[model samples]
Target: MKSCLVVDDSKVIRKVARHILETLDFSVEEAEDGRQALDRCAAQMPDVVLLDWNMPVMGGMEFLRNLRQQDFDTQPKVVFCTTENDVAHIRAALDAGADEFVMKPFDRETLESKLQIVGVA
Candidate 1:
């Protein structure tokens, strides 16, 4: 099965995302912040990352920048999962190397579609 890392500071959000991804047949891992997520990636990169924008320790943008610079065997497809819906924010994320963006309060269908768009689901 494919793997996914759900990087979010909120326990509830992580739990919800875990359920969705698990139901979709992904092996899920959770991280409370970008730093932790980065460590997890270094150990074993997941097929996709569901990243939140305003995490402590390190934010999503910083993580994306750092992750892009690393020489992983297979680059994980990053999808920013956040409340930030501004065009500029989206543009910045895309420029920073995120493959897709999914706004907060998303349902199973929305998440599934975004994952599929990134070719991870």
Candidate 2:
């Protein structure tokens, strides 16, 4: 099964994403912040990362930069999942090496479509 890491500070958001990804046949893991997510990736890189923009320990942009610097067997696709809908934020994420973007309050279909676009679904 494809693996996915859901990085979000909110437990509710993580739970929701976990359920949706599980239904899509992804082996899901959760991280409360970018630091933990990076650690998780170091141990076992997932096929996709659903990352939030803001967090206490490292933000998504920083994580993306750090993640892109790593040498992995197959670099995981990163999709920014956040409420930041501004063009600057979106552009920043893409420039930071994110493969896709999904806004907050996303549903199954939205998540699936973004994942598909990143070739993770």
Off-target runs (Cα >4 Å) in candidate 2 are none
Q: Which stretches of candidate 1 lie over 4 Å from their true place?
A: none
Clashing pairs in 1: none
Q: Which candidate is the best by TM-score?
A: 1
- The TM-score measured for candidate 1 stands at 0.99
Candidate that would win on lDDT: 1
Q: After superposition, how far is residue 44 of candidate 1 from its true place, in Å?
A: 0.8
lDDT of each: 0.96, 0.94
| Cα-lDDT of candidate 2 | 0.94
Candidate 1, residue 100: lDDT: 99
RMSD of candidate 1 to the true fold? 0.5
Query: Across residues 17-104, which tens digit of lDDT does each residue of candidate 2 receive?
Result: 9999999999999999999999999999999999999999898888899999988777899999999999999999998899999999
